[model samples]
Target: DAMVIQNPRYQVTQFGKPVTLSCSQTLNHNVMYWYQQKSSQAPKLLFHYYDKDFNNEADTPDNFQSRRPNTSFCFLDIRSPGLGDAAMYLCATSRDNGNTEAFFGQGTRLTVV
Candidate 1:
């Protein structure tokens, strides 16, 4: 069974338009992470919520924002998506902050037009 679920597997948004990608998990994991991956590149950690505590990566752009209202849900909001912002957004969940096996969603492929 899929523990982590990301909705709208493929999304197309116009340039400068805002879009939000959602993820929900059944595992009740404490850590939920959002990553951005470009073609042939490694996934970059955008941010994560560790049980209500939000942690953002230093290099993450201001255009990206995230919300974790509760344990099961998390959302990534792109304020003004540019062409370069198009990527595959992956949602992951882990039991803890320490080294642990993480469950990943199928991911949402975003296209900025």
Candidate 2:
């Protein structure tokens, strides 16, 4: 079945170091989003690309950034992952707005050392 995929199910990085988490999908969806979730907290929308239109959440940290070079691929880059940056990074995709449902990847668990 078509779905989202996140690489390196877990990532370990030192404080103030850069890291990149990847996400891709076979769903052929028009929108892809990156979310940061800590423990049992609600997933926080970082940013998303809707057919190349990048929409960033107002509360997303400056240390976080995203890129989508094409339809089925997207990436999350952390300029400097802090101790608090340690969290589960999820990638999700949706067909369109309104009546669409999002599918999530297994997620990359980031651990700041």
Candidate 3:
């Protein structure tokens, strides 16, 4: 399967705590992305790594950070979690940027305590 795998499928952090979510792709892809999805809302693109370049979405919050140390792996770090930041974090991969087929992991559900 052309799959993206996310670790520790669910996470709960104390308010203002820092948390990091990880993703690894089985398929060798050029584009890896991180998105945040809240209940009843669309999945919002936070950032992406196209090869060695990093692209951050305009409206993505400063609290969100990402790192692509290598093509096969990426990391999403939430600097400080808040009640409003609790949501499902999705990791995805594609051959290229937008307008292409992307495969997503099951997602990590983050809860703020």
Q: Which candidate is the best by lDDT?
A: 1
Model 1 clash count equals: 0
What TM-score would every model get versus the actual structure? Answer: 0.99, 0.96, 0.95
How close to the true structure is residue 90 of candidate 2, measured as C-alpha lDDT?
A: 95
lDDT of 3 at 73: 96
| lDDT tens digits, residue span 1-113, model 1 | 88999998999999999999999999989999999999999999999999999999999999999999999999999999999999999999999988899899999999999
For candidate 2, the lDDT comes to 0.93
lDDT per residue (tens digit) for residues 23-106 in model 2: 999989999999999998999999988899999999898999998999988999999989999999999999986589999999
Ranking by TM-score: 1, 2, 3
Which candidate number has the best TM-score?
1
Q: Rate the local accuracy (lDDT) of all candidates.
A: 0.97, 0.93, 0.93
RMSD of each: 0.5, 1.0, 1.2
Candidate 2 deviant stretches above 4 angstroms: none
Model 1 stretches astray by more than 4 angstroms: none
Comparison by TM-score, 1 against 3, better one: 1
Question: Could you tell which candidate, 2 or 3, scores higher by TM-score?
Answer: 2
